[model samples]
Target chain A: MTSALSAEGLHTYYGKSHILHGVSLEVAEGRITALLGRNGAGKTTTLRSLMGLTQAREGKITIFGEDTTRWPTFRIAAHGVGYVPEGRRIFANLSVEENLKVPLERGGPWTIERIYKLFPRLAERKQNRGRQLSGGEQEMLSIARALLLNPRLLILDEPSQGLAPLIVREVFRIVQQMKAEGISVLLVEQNARMSLEIADDAYVLDDGAVVYSGTARELAADDARVRALAGASAEEWTLT
Target chain B: MMTQLLLFNVTNGLIIGAFYVLMALGLSLILNLSNVINFAHGGFLVIGGYIAYTITPYIGFWGALLLAPPLTAIIGLAVERVLIRPLYGRDPLYSLLLTFGLAFMIEDGTRFIWGPQGKPVTIPAFLAQPLSNDLFFITGYRLFMVVVVMIAVALLFLLLRYTRLGVRIRAGTLDLETVAALGINVGMLRSLNFAVGIFLAGLSGVLAAGQLGLEPTMGTGLLMPSFIAIIVGGIGSLPGTLIGGLLIGVASGVTAVFFPAASEAVIYVMMAVILLTRPRGLFGEEGMMS
Candidate 1:
């Protein structure tokens, strides 16, 4: 299958100390690719580097067969990539509707009306400021905002972080729904079990380098390796 | 007789308050989106007055009034691109110092170009007249300035509320990184925002020139009050600046009638009281700029 995005030999740094050391990964077209790592394993940094939010000292990032290594964040976004950063960085001062309107309206199947229909909770709180929304609702709004960009590849950084188990399940369902709609997804999550269940392909990152790269089913089946590589969160597989 | 005097002072205060609002709103806009305290804002005002003064001989007051602000905005756009653009994402102190230095350069530059002597912007003869003998202080030009400020303010609000650029600006002010991730050219947005702020400054200059007359040092005197207006209203809030400007104007104006020496000091006192009580200005959001 053709890849939606591929990053090779990514060497990223924050000031002097190195964060990502030759980290490389790929997202298959119309499939969810899970990148699982423990705390401080550089999952978010990898996402940031691919999106050009932080430049990689040495790497090549190609999206849909085009080089995007040197592109700026907005240019990368404009080229049909939607990113929902960690912490659900909602514009607290803006209303729900205004937050949705912040993304440049790329022509696509997703529109504000469709977003409201998909997330009725957001429609109910249309006039409410983003800060007023609960964590679950903020995640929904962040996802809805990215969807409005009508991206070919949607990169979500820790959508399930700081969320209730029920909300986490709901977010996973939405990821599955996006894949069903033919959009490729690159999911970075600490909850390995939930991510592995929904993901088709998987890469386990340990200490800023890929420790294991294989099919999601293969990684999920091996409990010993999943625990060894993804750390303690792999045990969360039994809870959900 | 006493009530009539009070009424007159209140009216006078409101007119001055309107001028403060125009100037302060521009400063607030630039501060909100760009986080740049454009000390050169008053310098732009001086430029506007001088441009109007220089061109009035050929274009007339009405034409200069129509042309000056946008022309000043174009110059502001260039300054933003060339000088201010590099300092963005750096320490806020750098931009502040740069603009502070720029203010001095502008003052000296204008003095060199226009001479240090005051120059008057000739108003139409009809505008200089009062409506009646009893209200001799209410000249038609002052009334016209109020109307023009109101219209400009209304348009600014409409632009921020209805347009796509407006939505992006308000959103960027809250969270710029997210806005950039969503494919908005935040740099372009900021440049446009800076221009809008400078446009307001230029308009203030043109209006002030007609009333107070023009000198290279004129902008410096007006700059302090505009800064106070922002602090009194709250940073990052446009409506608050408007109210702050008017409140200070009225407070000072009424004080001028009762105690002439205390007129200017009253605004500072009001600011102190608001800070002690609310701590966020009248309309500032909690935890903002904390």
Candidate 2:
């Protein structure tokens, strides 16, 4: 499979506090790649680096077969990378429709109508400002907005961060829907079990370095390794 | 006589208030979007008035009115690109100080170009004439200024509401990072936003040249009231700035009748009361646009 995005030896830092240490991974075209780690495991940082929101002091990031490590956030985004940053970051002052209108640059297969069809709840609150939406609705709006970009690679950072498990399941369903539509996804999640279940390839990150990179199913069956890396209960790795 | 005095002062206050609204709205736009207090906003106003004056002799008042604002906006965009763009990620203090220095330079430059004496901009013969005998305080031009301001403000609000660029601006004002992530060029947004703000400043200068006459310090005189208007109206709310400008205009106008010396001082008193009672101004949204 062709790689949609690949980062080689990415060394990222936040003002001298080194966050990502030579971390390298590949997200294949049309497949979900999960980066799972503990809270301080640099999951969000890696996603941020790829988005060029923060620069990697040392490394190369190539997206859709082009070098994007030196590009700015807007340029990277313009190059068909859609990022849903952590915390939703919705423009609270803008109405739902207006938030949808915020991105001047548009892509295919994701018109406003198409997005509304995907999340009917967002359609109902079209006139409502972003702040009016509940957590689940906000997540849907974020995903819907990214879909409008019709991105080559969708980078989602903690889509299930602060939600009830039911809503999380719904968010994952949306993720599955994206995969069905044939778009590649680079997902950073703390919800290891759920991410691992949907992801084709997985990387277990510990202290800013990739401790394990292999097929998600293989990692799922290795209960001892899952516990060792993620500190999750070993039972989570067992196949239901 | 008292009723007549009341009518005159109230009308006078509103006209002054209109002037403040024009200036504050422009300044507010730049401050909210760029997080930079353009200390040179008044200087831009002076430049606008002077530019109109320079060209009025060549193209006449009608032509100057049409031409001056776009010219000012272009100058503003150029200034923003050359000077302000570098300081965006730095401390706001840098932009503030740079604009502050630019204010002095602009003042000196205008003085050097136009001379220190006040210069009168020629209004059309009909506009220079009073509307009627009953309300001589209301000039054709004063009413004209109010009407022009109303149209501009209305158009500005409409632009923010309807257009694609305007939607991006409103979104940028709230959360620029997300707008950028969505692939909108935020630097270009700031430049356009700055130009729009300066356009208003320029428009006000053209209007003011007719009423107060053009002088280097005229912009400086109006700048304080605009700042006060923004504070009293609520820092981030454009409508609040509108209301605040009008309120203070009428307040000062009314006060002139009772205590002639306290007219300018009354606006500060009103500002103090609002701050004490409601620190956010009338329409200010708490925890919004921080």
Candidate 3:
């Protein structure tokens, strides 16, 4: 299958510190690709580089055959790449409706009504400002806003971070729905077990490099090896 | 006698109050959209008054009124593109300092061009007549200013509340980053907003020339009072700025009538008292550093 998004030898920096050292990965079209890593594993940095939020020192990042390594964030977004940064950075002063409207793409299937149907809570609190919404509502709004762009590839940076279990489940459900609709996703998740369960392909990023890559089922079956590579406690695997 | 004096004070108050509202509204719009205090706002006003003065002799009063604001707006656009645009995402204090320096330059530039002597601009012959009754008398020029400002304020309020561009501006003011993400060119929107703000300041300055003498330093006098209005009204709220302006205008008018010696100091005193009681001013947001 043709890769919808591909990065080869990507090098990114924050100020003088080199955070992503020669990272490389590929996201197949119409599949849920999970990038699993522990804290400081460069998962967020990879997403940022892909979205052009941070400048990549050396690398070729292609989105649907177009090189976008040096493009600005706004231009990158215009090329059908939607980004949800790690923290739910919803505009605090804008109403839920306004927040959704602010990033409304000119022509797309993800209208306000469609997003409302997908996340009922957002519709219910459409008039409420960002500060008034609960954590789960904010996350849902963030995803809903990105989805409204009808992006060819959705890059979510730790969407489950701080979300309640029920909300996290809902987020995973949305990911499955996206996969079914043939939209590619690059999900960065710290929760290895849940992410592996939903993801079609899994990549283990450690020390700013892709240490392991395989089918999600293969990664799931090798419990001992996956745990050792992921550095997750035995309790975390058992919980799943 | 006291009742008669009170009536006079109230009339004077309304006139001055309306003028403050006009000036403060312009300042608030720029502050909300650009997130800059624009210390050079007063300079725009000074330039605007000069524009009117320069053209009034040739184009007549109505033509001068129309010509002054757009000219000032173009100058404002130049200021934003040349100076303000380069300093975005940096500390707000830097912009403040830069604009402060610009204000000094503008004031001095006007002095060099127009000279230090203040020039009194006479009201046009058509508006110089006074409408008087036994109890109350109003100058036609002052009344015309009040009416014109009221119309402008109403139009501004309508534009901000309605219209597609206005909607985008309102959204941008609340959160600029999100607006940009939506594919709206935030830089362009900011430039347009800066131009509109300068236009308003220039409009106010032209109207003010009819009331007071035109001098390079006239804008300097208006700056502190306009700022006080903004602080008291709330930094970003339009209606709040209006109220703040009117409040200062009336208080100053009344002080001038009753306590002539302390009239100049009254606004500062009132500001101090308001700060002591409600640091955010009457309508200001809680915890807003400005």
Best by TM-score: 2
Candidate order by DockQ, decreasing, is: 2, 1, 3
Could you give candidate 3's per-residue lDDT for residues A105-166 as a string of tens digits?
65877788988998889889988888899988999888887877778888888887787777
Residue B105 lDDT, candidate 1, scale 0-100? 95
User: Worst ten-residue run, lDDT, model 1 chain A?
Assistant: A231-240
| Every candidate's chain B TM-score | 0.97, 0.97, 0.93
Candidate with better lDDT, 2 vs 3: 2
Model 2: per-residue Cα lDDT over B133-252, one tens digit each? 877777899899999999999998888877878888888888888888888889999999999999999999999997888999888888999999999999888889999999999999
TM-score of each: 0.95, 0.96, 0.86
Runs with alpha carbons beyond 4 Å of true place in candidate 1: A228-231, A234-240, B286-290
Candidate 1 residues B1-290, lDDT tens each?
A: 77778878998899889988999999988989888998999999999999999999999999999899999999999999999999999888999999999999999999999998999889999999997898878899989999999999999988887687888988888888888899998899999999999999999999999999999988888888888898998887888899999999999999999998999999989999999998888888732221
lDDT of 1 by residue, A114-167 (tens): 999999999999999889999999999999999999999999999988888888
lDDT of 1 at A139: 97
Tens-place lDDT digits, model 3, residues B30-143: 778777888999899999999999988999878989999999999999999999999877888989999999999999999999998997776777677766664454678878
DockQ-derived CAPRI band for the predicted complex in model 2: medium
Query: Which pairs in model 1 have colliding backbones?
Result: none
Ranking by lDDT: 1, 2, 3
